[model samples]
Target: MLVLGIESSCDETGIALYCTRRGLLAHALHTQMAMHAEYGGVVPELASRDHIRRLVPLTQSCLKDAGADFADIDAVAYTQGPGLGGALLAGASYANALAFALDKPVLPLHHLEGHLLSPLLTDEGVDFPFVALLVSGGHTQFMAVHGVGDYVLLGETVDDAAGEAFDKTAKLLGLPYPGGAKLSELAELGTPDAYRFPRPMLHSGDLNMSFSGLKTAVLTAVEKARAEHGGSLPESVRNDICRAFQDAVADVLAAKAAAALRQTGLRTLVVAGGVGANRQLRQRLCALTIGKEAVQTFFPPPALCTDNGAMMAFAGAMRLRHGVQAAAPAGAFTVRPRWPLAQLSP
Candidate 1:
């Protein structure tokens, strides 16, 4: 089947074409990071407008690169929610409209399901019945994957997600907007033991996690540093703080992931979403040894780790193959602004 995927969940507009028989045919994306950076964060109005401007062109580019035309598409898949209402509407409306025009079915996919299933896009030999660690800007959770559309929530954050903590703490340190990646980069230059941060919920005896307290701890440390340094934090000190924070987050995630694997008796761990691209987190997961056995870990390509159309396309294809019916018609469709992954089933 040929599926055209559209993703406009937030600051990025992503479009792609996926062929069930040939894998991902082509994809295109336009990130609003630079624009949102000027405002210190994403302005939803601007994001929605940009999605409107970029979607058509990006879809056209994707189709051109795929060497295909609208006539060849069998379905239009799009993110339906758990994201900005306006951004979700842009993609949802476009997908429904396009599907209606093509006289094809529309597949409304859960955003987190896209991230959870992204690892399967690669030939990583990842099978069903694996544990998934979905760490992203808006979500942080562990899920037991039995198969397509069959996901059991293992645990999740009680407050801020790991990525949210990263961005919030980065801003507290005076970093620019879209600070997660920058914070990770700065962490590379930090001394390993220059600072220490608490690992929240490390021993909470559950798969559930928490990062709010960690962010508070970072804020406290920042205040102390500023007070001691005459209101100016040294670059080295800031980098060290970033490192410590990253280390603590990575440790918690790694520990929880291992616990989830043990709980499910699933040796394979599939890590997906934006924060899965973290080098430290990747290293930690790869090195995770649960007792005498080593765990297998999988991750999408770094470029695919963020919100993108390819994962959506691939996920839609899987759903279709698993007998999930698409939306009956494009008219009178609505997007879910807060859908949960566990609510999905084949």
Candidate 2:
């Protein structure tokens, strides 16, 4: 079966074709990060409008890349919930309309589920009952997974997500918006012990985490350095602060992840979402799990770690193979801005 996926949940417009027998055939994406950078964040209205303009063309390009045509598509999958209403609608409307015209089924996918399942698309060793750590711009969550669609929330951030913390802290340092990756790059040049930031709730003894306070702590550090220096904080000092901040986040995440693994007794750890792209976090996670204790660590290639349509297509294909019904014809449906992924089934 062939599934064409559409994703416009945020500032990216992604389209892809996933063939059950052949794997991912084609995928196209346009990130609005640079466009929204001037404003320091995503503009929902602008994001939605851009999706409207890009969806059709992107689908066409994906089809061409796959060497397939609309007639070859068996089903259409689109991100349907847990996103900005307007943005979701853009993809939803297009997917539904196309499915109706093609006389094909529509698959309404949960965005987070796509992220959770992403690691499986490439990693051959991943299996059921993995511990999931999804760290994105908008979400930081841990789940206990037992096979496809069987997800139980283990713990999550109570405030800002890890990616958000990175960006916010970077912003405070005069870095560009959407600065998470940039912040991480700078941290690589910094001395690991030059500064120390708290690892919040590291020993709280529960899965729940708090990162907003961690961000505030970074702000406090920046302020103290500026005040003490009488004008500007040195570049090395800023890099040190970045290093300390990244360390705090990586430590908290790594510690919590190990805890989740111990608590669930799951041997597989799959990291997804944007923040999963962090080199230090990857190093820490690998250091903790790799080549020891039967624990397997899997991460998508950096590009796939972020939001995209390929994961949606792959997830939809998984559902189709498992006998889940395709989405209803699109014009009659609505996006669930806050759907709980655990509510889905395989």
Candidate 3:
């Protein structure tokens, strides 16, 4: 079966083609980061417009790279939501229109599910019944995965997500837009223990987390440093703060992941979403030993770590392989701005 996936849940427009027998044939992505950078954040209107401009060309690019024709695509899959409504609509409309044109069935997939299942695209040896730590710009949660469409909510953030905190904290430290990656890079130059940020809810006796307070703590520290440094923070001081912040987040996530594994009695841990690409987090997880057994962690490739269509394509193919049928022909389609991953059933 061949599934063409379209992702426009947010600022990125991703298109891909996946063949069940051949794995991912090809994928193309166009991030609106540079455009949104000027605004210090994404503007929904701009994002939606960019998706309109990129989707068709990107899909064509994917087909060209795969050496496949539109007739070869058997199904069309798109992110059904948990994102900007306008952006979601762009992808949904395009996907449904394409499916209708090709007389192919449409599959409305949950965006988070796409991210959760992405690691499987590369690690073919990974089986079901694993623990998943999904941390991204808008979501931070732990889930127990029994199989495709079978996910149980383990825990989630009670406040700001880890990625949100990273971006907000970076902004507070005078970093540019899309600050999370820059913050992480600066952290590498920081001296160990020069600064130590709070690890919020690291021991609340549950899987739920809190990072909003951590961002406030960073603000407080930044204010103090500015006041002490005559209203200007030194470069070294900023780097140390970034390092402290990253360390705290890494420590909290790594500890919670280990706990989740122990609680579920699962040794295989899959990390997904943009924040899952954190080098420090990956390193910490790789070193984790749950109880006496070492934990095995899996992550999608760097390109797949962020929002992309290939995950949706691969996930759709998996569902099809599991006997889940695509949507019947319809006159109109809608997208979900907020949908729970647990709502999907096997």
Writing each residue's lDDT as its tens digit, candidate 2 over 1-346 gives 9999889898999998999999999899999988899899999999999999999899999988888989999989999988999999999999998988998888899999999999988887888878999999999999998877778999999999999999999999999988888999999999978888888899999998889987788889899999999969899999999999999999999999988998987778999999999998998998776336856789999989888999999999988787665445545878988887778854
21-128: candidate 1 lDDT, tens digit per residue: 999999998999999999999999999999999999999999999999999999888998889999999988888888888898888889998899899998559988
Best by lDDT: 3
Judge candidate 2 at residue 322 and give its lDDT: 71
Best by TM-score: 3
Arrange candidates, best TM-score first.
3, 1, 2
Q: Please, what are the lDDT tens digits per residue for candidate 3 over residues 1-346?
A: 8999999999999999999999999999999999999999999999999999999999999999999999999999899898999999999999999888998888988999999999999988789899999999999999999999999999999989999999999999999999999999999999878988788889998999989988888899999999999999999999999999999999999889988998999999999999998999899999999767888889999899999999999988988888765555734888999898988865
Error of 2 at 52 (Å): 0.7
What ranking emerges by lDDT with the best candidate at the front?
3, 1, 2
TM-score (C-alpha, index-matched) for candidate 1? 0.98
Q: What ranges in model 2 sit over 4 Å off?
A: 289-292
